[model samples]
Target chain A: MDSIFAIPLISAIVSIAGNLAVFRKASFLIAGVAHSALAGVALAIFLASISIELDYFLVATLFAIFFALLATTFSKFSDIDTGIGVSFALAMAIAVILISLTRGYTAKLWAFLFGELFLMTEKDFLYISIALVAILLIFGFFYDKLIFFLFDPEGAEASGINTRLIDAIVVAIVAIAVVAVIRAVGAILAYSIFVAPSAVAKKFSKSVAQSLIYSFLITLICLILGLIVSSAIPISASAISAFIASIIYLLVAIEKS
Target chain B: MAIEAKDLSYSYGKTIALENLSFKIDDGEIIAILGPNGAGKTTLLKCILGLLRANGEISVLGRDPRKDKKVLNMISYVPQRSSLSIDLPIKVLDVLKMTCKEIDSEILRHLELENKLDLLFRELSGGFQQRVLIARALMKRPKVLLLDEPFNGVDVLSQKRIVEVLERSGATTLVVVHNINPVLHAVHRVMLLNKKLVAFGKANEVFRRENMVKVYGAEIPLVVCEEGVVHPLYGDQHG
Candidate 1:
């Protein structure tokens, strides 16, 4: 039980870091790729693992590396015909069905879906803190390259910008982040923390730099509030944060329109 | 260095798009590529742009366009108007604006589209969309402007306006025009293509009735009756 919990919880920790990335205008595909990989592992454990080992940090590290590799590879083919959107959606669907079929053996499946961030534990929180620092450093270093790609991919490529390499690296981050978030909010909802804040922030900014700045600030606020709300009110941290994010996006959209 | 193509050839699958095409575009000279339907005119431009692969050495501004980003950045391309996505929620000004260090109002005024920046690109007429694209290309301040069938579905007035803009762009402009009359006097050099180099020289010298008959597969009849002399029925059938 602890091992199963370990995989998702550590993933949720990384999810926070990846979610931080969306503030810098990373593509939604990265988040999806990351979530899909975690969902694959969670689905596997739900069906086969009779005993849980949530304390295995090495298992989390291996999953991060594996998911990151998949993400990097997928971004290169993101331009291909229907491979990005179609295949990923189908994979997510298959994961849902497999989890549903295994429902009789493990009611903890639903717990994984909603996440138990309230139980992120002192150790998991420490891991999350370290992951956030790493994410911040990476984001700071590659901020210019990432911003340029989003605005004009063709122009950037024509200018001989190494967009393909940047794209692949972003994928790696997404895969790792999705795994991190899986422990708290599950696979499907992890995307909310990743994409919503940035998308909402874009409604107000004129420049890409401004958009990224606001997106990160918004994400940080949501995380702090989500953690606090879930603690005080006995609700899922992910759900509370997601609800707040959705409302903020709605208000931003409505205010602009 | 002047752009030159020697024994240049290209193909798309089994069908031949260009065969042994050869010509030289002198420095600072505007050359208009003239042809009818299926004339392989675009293939030649694509070769120059390095969008399509070809046999034989083709040099643009002395550098291979395929491997040269500096050339690509220096060369302005006005792709076919229809190739652009119309309903992308992008604004006219948004498309026109680029990595140019400075944004000047004079460029928009010259194109006579100074006031329509915020309008959605899809909402603009076909002519306006073409102008917007031109503005985008001009944003780079390129030395060579390459246009592929830019006048398609455009009005005569817009055609004249576009021609005037390109002339004033202070660049060696190359245009692909299907009809000759609108651009015959406007263009300096003409490269007639029908899967190969039919003719390449001065517009008036190369676009004569004899050359048109040879390349277009139709002879324009001139009938002198009583007190009147009738020229080719459809004006200038070839350019």
Candidate 2:
């Protein structure tokens, strides 16, 4: 029952925040940070067995933020994609090592790997809701400035917009959003929902507001439809949702071409 | 002086982009900066705008652009059209909205962009895109305006409109152009640069064969029109 409500809610939040990331050209950066978040989660689980207490969400958020800053620093001297690729690889390796070091949490960790929506408790939903609210507030307050920066960075800087600060804030927000949703949908499916809707919306909409609306609607529809289809045919909801999103993107590409 | 630079210099690691350059512009004068690719034309503009930190002193409107960010309220910049993200889903109106709280419809009508407000920026032709950029700059009612490669990819008609707008702007304008023939008549003076200040004076006085050779490393053919205006015949060398 909670899965029914949680999937659509999380999807809505990811679409809006994800589309903003798309505008900033930080989609892959989100992926890299999301992977780093996994290492943080695994480390927390491993530490708990040694009788050391650390909040997994706090550690994951910190790890993702660190990866975000690292990727940004790497991007300064090289292509952004290359920086993100390196961060992604390093984080994945660390996560595997940490997972190997842990014991008797295989079932719990596996649920995080592919996302078990049915396992979400009320507390999980509340935490994600707080993240959604934070994303909305930050984006809403800085919408015009962010749009100006994304449109023309040099112009924004000349206008005294503090573009570097804006860049840092944007990547940090994406990092937070990725960490919040990674466990709910897993890394792979999180990326699909984060990018696919915005990519499709960019083709269909003529304005930023229109694009945001379209992206949100597309994600919500995919999540709800995935749920309905999974109920009839015993399939994983996250897999079905991601598959539907990909199919929509492919169809959009073919039609546009 | 609307802008002044004293021995301004900048280097990117080992490569010196600008070297010991000093010049000044009177208020409301339209000066065109001419230089070949990598001649530090854009870098000079960035220095004046305080986007890049330089070794020497620079001032705009009696304020150090790097030290006093309040100067930004009285200045505007229109970067090259190519610098913009080509696929953003932003409308002409959206770009204007970012500049100020209210859109000056008068500026829109002047640029002939009022009707095109609903169109996405990427959907517009190159000419219209340049106009929109200029229009966005003008909306701030700046005391100083800097434009980089405004003529690139623009049609002849849009170029004319751009010149007209700049003429009426009454701001201290510094425009960087590759082919100065199009804007030669509109500019009050020409500041030729090739990593260093080559010449800064009236176009006729500055376009001497030696000046052309010194900056461009070649003898650029010069033509004198009926009005005795000197026009340098050279292909556009934008990068």
Candidate 3:
């Protein structure tokens, strides 16, 4: 198995963790978006690099995003906006510099920049499948509680839900998902898997649970089709997935129209 | 008892928001808590909801408020209008759906908000926002409705309308009202407060010029003529 696939699988899990943790706090929306952007930037850097251990680099970036997100979101790191800007800027700048140093900023960078490659190993495929199952299990267990916390904790608490515990469970799920998908989409585009499906689903959802289910189905379709098209057409799975997602969004819009 | 408190004292970094306060609300009575600015009216409401940690014995719906939150859910809280941000990206009808159990189609129609359900919640006026919260509180079918300053910037017509709804609901209502005249007839009793309970009972008994002076200080010049009707001659700003 090519080591690069391992990175995305782990990344997918960790990214999900980060996204889920912030769903309870006041800045959940901001936290989700910022972490997503950071993940995208990191994956872009990896795509630009050569001779780098794909697993090590992906794990480092995941840790960096998780640590930075938690420190900035949970703690008062000189205010939220300032902390997000500074942390994200530093991480992206460092990753970009490293990528440039390796490749001298040539057109070859586009392969990584725009997701123009699809290389996978047997182990990576297995890991991703297992990670996907784990993600489903975690989500199913905490679905009701997480939905309640996101919408209204006062009501959640009134209904005898341990909001904080439920919030923690969601964080764990997002983290695992982020770790798992890191290779499939990379750091930069990983959140596309986490957020896009949910976002597009929002326009059509009647309830939080429905939106979540819609997002899961949309994600499953993207992963399968993206992997297939990339292997057959010599394109990057990341880019293919994004294109397919956009198509899905368009379909939704057209259907609504 | 529907609600009971004894020696209730709450502190916000030693500021003493509520000081050794004692009060009770019966099973089914509309009580108004009247006080000057900063007189701890809101503090009293929070104390009952257990939102504010207090040093006193408090019970609601036959359970300790600090222990069982389910018992607290039996009570609906209408928080200060100033504390909430309405401009968030949520529809008025959507928020109402989140509040109540069933989201009855007749609720907004009953509150005269049937046409404005699709609008952004933050886009509404202050009166409209309060009404939305009132509708949320009403949806709970709470045994006790604790409203804090619900009528700020409210028009007389809307106030009368709200009073009519509360009067007809038959729930135990505890309201913090600024105006005494309009509520003189609505509430079954009024609690005059000044960091403490100055007096508690029927509005006619507690709305005396002497009690008003005690609660508001000498600054409020109330003209209590020989006929027993009291009129506000000047505004008092004491707490």
Candidate 4:
């Protein structure tokens, strides 16, 4: 419920999930999943307006996971990037339609777009904590196999690693992480946390563990800095955090070049 | 027999990748699968690994690879070195340790990669990368080893080291290569392919001018050395 504790927990989840996304080369895929969550949020709000109760987080998780798997299936017909791109457009289109059908939806939209961390309830924190634990346990247990599959998928499969199960786990992680982070920081800001830290970390990291630690440190810094700066100014913390993340990524890219 | 195929065929939609191809590999024999680009060399290996479902029968170690999930435990694969585009900072030790708990340091020593275990995989030269992959495949002590383009982009010395290791591996190996020259002395038989099994026999018998022309679509010049080994001269491009 407290903004002080919420920032760090969200940062940890985003950093680890973001690092995995970078390794999977699924930044856009994760972004697509986050964007698709808007559809579920809008549908949930629309149902609420009609006197039907539904949890937005629950609906968003389902939507994100569906779109994530759908993108993979579409990849069989085309390249992965194209599949994700198409799925992203479709998700946005559905979101727009759902948004139009809902009345008095601006407050809900604003909450999701810029995040309402200050408005987060005890339930949201519990859900996020559970997600963080699940991510840590699953990724920690399967780190080696995951690395092998990501490094050389064919070789991993031939070596008897259940690659399909790995795929499912990865897809689930990306989808769930995106949905959970979006519910906390909103979709646009969540995208930055899910990608920027990991991208910058990859530039300086010498190994996977180094990359993960660097990513977590960078995300935590941005989140804390955003909170401090937003307190001094009249800006939203989520917006400031996203801006800081992007600026850091730009500086790193420039330095690398 | 270690591997046998009967009327085994596969296609990507209507496009035929392989057709009516059948062959048998003896136990502990090292065979080379040669072809120009898109010759289905990789496809055949995929079939044996059960990575792809094909028409007809393919038996590996007297079991249908497609039906028996356990067959995967007996096989290890080295995909094309150039085909891997990993951005992760995984090390050589990480790769070698993926399949086996205790890596055979002897294999690493043979490949001259024992010291490079700490280096990032992407930091390695093409030759070292190929050697690392081969070493990883060997770590499993697989009954059947499948290597797809194992020597692609490898240095001369690395190539020799790889062949030496493969010869000593003593596994039923199927090495898919663009050209047979690099592994000529090591492999017992050469299976020349171009969308079909053009020739499959002893190197001396299959390395004939007609077979070369039929498969490669050009007359590849061959020179017989003092050891009676036939060497083909031509550029083999990856498809």
Model 4 CA deviation exceeding 4 Å by range: B235-239
Question: Which candidate gets the maximum DockQ versus the true structure?
Answer: 2
Error of 1 at A120 (Å): 3.4
Report the C-alpha lDDT of model 4 over B65-179, residue by residue, as the tens digit: 8889799888988888655655678878887888887889899999999799999888988899889888988889999999998877788999999999999999999999876
lDDT of 1 at A78: 68
Going through the candidates in order, their DockQ values are 0.12, 0.82, 0.14, 0.72
Leading candidate by TM-score: 4
Residue-level lDDT tens digits of model 4 in A49-160 = 8999998889988998888888888887988888888888898898889888988975887788677655678878877888888888998898888888888878888877
TM-score of structure candidate 2: 0.96
What class would a CAPRI assessor give candidate 4's docking?
Answer: medium
Error of 1 at A240 (Å): 3.8
> What TM-score would you give candidate 3 relative to the actual structure?
0.61
Model 2 spans with C-alpha error above 4 angstroms: B236-239
DockQ of 4: 0.72
lDDT of 1 at B125: 85
Per-residue lDDT of B229 in model 4: 84
lDDT of each: 0.63, 0.85, 0.63, 0.85
Candidate with the larger DockQ of 2 and 4: 2
Which candidate do you rate higher for TM-score, 3 or 4?
Answer: 4
lDDT tens string, model 2, A111-199?
Answer: 56666554577777776788788878888888788889989999999999989888887887787787777766777677887788998
Q: B113, model 3: CA deviation in Å?
A: 4.8
